[model samples]
Target: MDKQTSRNLWRITAGQRLRYASAIAVTGLASAFMLSVPLVGGYVLDVVDTQDLAQGAALLVEAANTLAVEIGGKPYVAYLVLSAVAGVGLTALGATCQYLQGRWAAIASEALARRLRETMYERMQHLPASFFDEADTGDLVQRCSSDVETVRVFLSSQVVQIGRSILLLSVLTPILFARDARLASLALVLMPFIIAGAYYFFAKVREQFKITDESEGALTARLQENLTGIRVVRAFARQAYEVEHFGSKSLALRDNRERLNRLSGAYWAVSDFLCTAQVCIVLIAGGMFLAAGSLSVGELFAFMMQVTMVIWPVRHLGQVLNESGKAMVSLGRINHVLLAEEESRDPAPATERVRGELVLENVTVEYEPDRPVLKDLSVHIPAGETVGIVGPPGAGKSTLIRLLARLYEPQHGRILIDGLDLLEVDRHWLRRQLGIVMQDPFLYSRTVADNLRVARADVNDTEMMAAAREAAVHDAIVGFPAGYRSRVGERGVTLSGGQRQRLALARALLVEPPILVLDDALSAVDTGTEGQIMAALERRRGRHTTIIIAHRLSSVRGADRILVLEQGRLIQEGTHATLAATSGPYRRLCEIQGALDEAIERDLKETSNAV
Candidate 1:
C-alpha cells in the first residue's frame, strides 16, 4: 500500500490493533505445534519397523526401555505408543491455539467494523457541502457498508493467513532439505509456477471485483431514487417504464458479477491441478528412494506427510490473494471520502448576539468557472427591518440565501453581518443565528413535538405551542390522532403540503433566530393562513429581521421594501406600491396576475348567474 492508504487503514483499526496482533501471535504458536505432528508420525512408524532406534532416539530409548518393562511389551512397541501419544497431544495444543485465535479475531473484526462506520459518518458531517453536489447517495452508502465488509473479511482471515504461509515456508523447506535434498528440490519445482499463477489471478480478479462493486453501487442508486420518487412514478402511470429501467441497472450488475465468478472458476481450476500434481511428484520420488534402500518406508511416509502439509497452505494462498485484492480496492474507496476537505471548524465567538445586520458589497458567486451566479450584487439590510426579494428564475435569489447560511462562499466579494466578515467568524455560529426554511422543507420520521423541538433540546410544551401558533399550525397539530405525539411519516409524508411547510416554519421559529428567511416557504399555505403567519411576523415587527422571497406580488406587497432582480442583477428597489406604480418587472408581473384573477372572477360570476 502507499503511505497514505496504509495510514488510513491503520487509523481506522485503532482501539483494536493490539487484539489483532495477539491473534496473529497465537496463530504462529499454533503453526509450531501443528508442524510437529508429521515428525511424530514418522518416528512412530520407524519405531514399529525396527528394534534399533535412529541417532536422534537416545531420549526415546530411555523412555521406551522403562515403559517396555512396565507394560510388558517390546521396546519398539512401547516407543510406538509414546509417539502416538505425542502426536495426539500436539494436535490438541494446536486446536486450542486455533480456538483462541478465532475468538480474538472475531472480537477485533467487529470493533474494526464499528470504527470504520463511525469514521466515515463523522467525516461526512465535516465535509464541505460542495463534495456532495455531484455525488450519489447510493454509491456513498455502498462504500460505507459493502466495501467496509470486504475489508473486515480480509482482516479476520487473510491477514493472519499471510503470516501462517510465511512461517510454513520458512520452517518446512529446511526440514525437507535436511531429510533428502534431491526429493525436496523436486517438490519445489512447481512453487515458482504457483506464485506466478497467484499473481496473475489476483491482477485479473482485482479489476473485475472493482468493476462489480461500482456496478452494484449504481444499481443501488437507481433503486434509491426510484423508491424516493415512487409516488411520482405512479401518478404518471410509468410502472412499466420504471421496471424496464430498473431491469437495465440490475442486468448490468449481474454481468459484472458474472465476469468475476468466471475468473474465479478458472483460477481455482489451474491452482487445484498444480497443487495436486506437486504432491504426487513428492510421493512418487520418495517411494523410489525407499526402493533404492537409501530411505526406509517409515522415512518415506514422513516425507509424504510433510509434503502434503506444505502443499495445503500453498493451495490456500490463492484464497488469501483473492481477499487481499478485494481489501485493497475497498480501502481505496473509503479513503476517497476521508481525504476530502472539510469546512472550517466551529469556534467560540466573541459574543452571542449578531444584531441581524447584513451587507453584500460587489458580491460575485459562481458554481462554475466563468459563469457567475451572482455578479456585482450589492445590498444592505439593517437590523429590525422587513424586506422582500422578487426575481425571475435563475436570477440568484436562492443563491443569496445559501450565501447567508455559509453553504457557499462568494468567489470575489465579501459578506458581513454586524460588520463582521463571514469568512473570519465561525460558520456554525453564523448558521445558528440565521433560521432558514426552504421551499421544500424536510422533516424527520418523528412526532409533531419532536420536529418542532429539533433545533433546541430544552424546548418545553409552552414554547412548542407558542411557536406552532405563530406559524398557524398549532390547531392542526392538536387535531392529529395523538396530538403533539403523533408520528409523521418519512419527510412528513403523512402531512399535507401546507402542514409540512407550517411545521417546518414552527421548527425554525422555536430556535428564535435573529434573522428569519422564508424562501418561498409559505407558498403551499392557503391565502388566509398566509395572512395569519404574516400578521404574526408583523406583530413582532422590530424584534427580528425577516426576508421573504415569493413570486406572488401580494406576498411581498406588505414588506417595507421590495427588490427585483433579473439575470444576476438588481433592476428595481422600492416599496410594493411604489414599484407597482412605476413601469418595470414588478409592474409587469402585477398586471399579468391582475388580468388572470379578473378573468377567473368574471367566469365565476357568469356561472352563478346561469345557475
Candidate 2:
C-alpha cells in the first residue's frame, strides 16, 4: 500500500489498533502451549515404553519412584494419569486463548470496517455535484461495501494468522537448533526459496487482484445502470442489446477472477510441496541419527515435530501474502475516494438573511474546459420581482438558474445576492433560502404529504395542503385511496410525470424560501393546471423573488418582465406585449408557438366533429 492509503487505514482504526495488538499477544501465548503439546507427548511416550518387559521399564520405574517419594507412595500409574491430565489441561488452555484472540481480532476488524464505511459515506455526501455527474453509483457502492469487507477479512484473518505464524517460527527455531543443529539446518534449507517465492507472488498477485477488483466494479456499474433504466430499455425494445452488454461485462469479471484464483492456487501448491519436502528431509535425517546413537527416539520425535511447526507456517505465510495483496489493492481504491477534494464552502458565518436580490455580471460557465455553456451573461432581478426567462434549447437557461442557486460557480465574472458575493456566502445557508424545482425533479418512495414536506420538515399538514393547493395538486392527492399517506413507488414511478412535477413544486413552496426558481417545473401539467398554479404564484409575487424559466410562452406572459435569450445572450427584455410587438427572437418564438397552438386546436375540433 502507498503511504497515504496506510495512513488513511490507520487514521480510521487508530482506536482499535491496541485491541489488535492485544489479540496478537494472546495468540503468541496460545502458540507456546500448542508447541509444548508435541514435546509433552514425546515425554509421555518415553515414560510408557515397555520394551524388554522382563527388565521392567527403567524410565517408568524411575518416574514412579520420584512421584512416590514426592507424594506418599503413589504408583507410576498415578504419575501417568497426572501427565495425561496436564496434556489435556494445556490443550484446553491453548484453545481458550485461541478463542479470545479470534474474538478480539473480530471486534477490532469489524469496528475498523464500520468506521471506514461511515467516513466514506459522509465524504460522498459532501462531494461536489460534478463528482456525482462523473462517478458511477455502482462502483462507489462496491467500494463502500464489498471493498471494505475485503479489507476486514485481511485484518481479521490474514493479519492475525501472519503474526501467529511468525511468532511460532521464531520461538520454535532455537529449540530445533538446540536439539540438533545439523538436522535443524536441513529443515530450514528451503527458507530462501520460500522468501523468494513470496516476493514473486506478492508482485504478481497484487496486480492480478487489482485487475479483478476493477473488473468487478465495472460489472457492477453496468448491472446497476441496466436495472435503474429498465423502463427506458423496455420502452426502446432494447432488452437483447442491454443483456448482451451486461453479459460482456459479467464475463470479463469472471475471467479476471478465475485468473486471480489460478495464480493463488499455483503459489500455494508450490509452497505446500516445498514445506512437505523439508519435513520429509528432517524425518529421514533424524532416523539415521537415531540409529547411529547420535539421537534418542523421543528426542528425534520432538525435533521432527518442531521442524514441522517451523515449515508449515511458511505455507501459511504464502497464503497471507496472497490475501494481504488483495486487501492492499482494495485499500488503495478506497483511499482514492477518501482523499478526493470535498466541495468548497466559505467558513464565514452567514449573518445576513437573503432578500433575493440576485445579479449576474458577465457570468460564464463551462462543464468542460473551453466549452462555455453561458458566456458573459448579465442580468438583474430586484427583490420581490417575478422574472420570466425564455430561451431556445441549449441556450444556458438551466445553467443560468443553477448559477443563481449557487449550485455551480461561474468561471468568469461574479454573482451577487442582496449585494453580497455569492461565493462568500455559506453554501448550506444559501441553499436553504433558495427553493428550486428543476425540469426533472426527483421524488423518494414516500407519501404525497411526506414528499411535499421534504424541503421543510417542520411544515404542518395545513401548510402542506396549502402548498399542494398552490401547485394545483390538492384534489389529485386526496383522490387517492389512502389520501396523503399513499406510497409513491421508486422515483415516483406510480405517479404520472405531471403529478410528480407538481408535487415537486409543492415541496419547494412548502419551504417558503425567500427565492424560488422554477426551471420548466410546470411543463408536465396541462394548460388548465398550469394557469391555476401561475395564478397562485401571482398572489405571492411581492412576498418573495421568483424566477420562472419556461418554454411555453403563455406561462411567462403575465410576468412583471420577460427576458428572451438566444445562444447564451439576452437578446430582448420587456413586458410580453412590448416583446411581442418588436421584431426580435421573442417575436419569432411567439409567432411559432401561436401557429403550433392553432394547429393543435384545429386538430382537436376536427376530431370532435368526426366523433
lDDT of 1 at 595: 99
**Candidate 2: where are CA atoms >4 Å away?**
49-75
Q: Per-residue lDDT for 429-520 in model 2, tens only?
A: 78877899988899999987778768888988898889989999889999999999999888898898899999999999987889999999
Return the top candidate by lDDT.
1
Q: Write the per-residue lDDT of candidate 1 for residues 100-166, one digit (tens) a residue.
A: 9888988888788888888899999888779898789989999999999999888787877877787
What lDDT does model 1 reach?
A: 0.87
lDDT agreement of model 2 with the native? 0.85
**Clash total of candidate 2:** 0
Q: Specify the poorest-scoring 10-residue window by lDDT in model 2.
A: 50-59
User: Which one wins on TM-score?
Assistant: 1
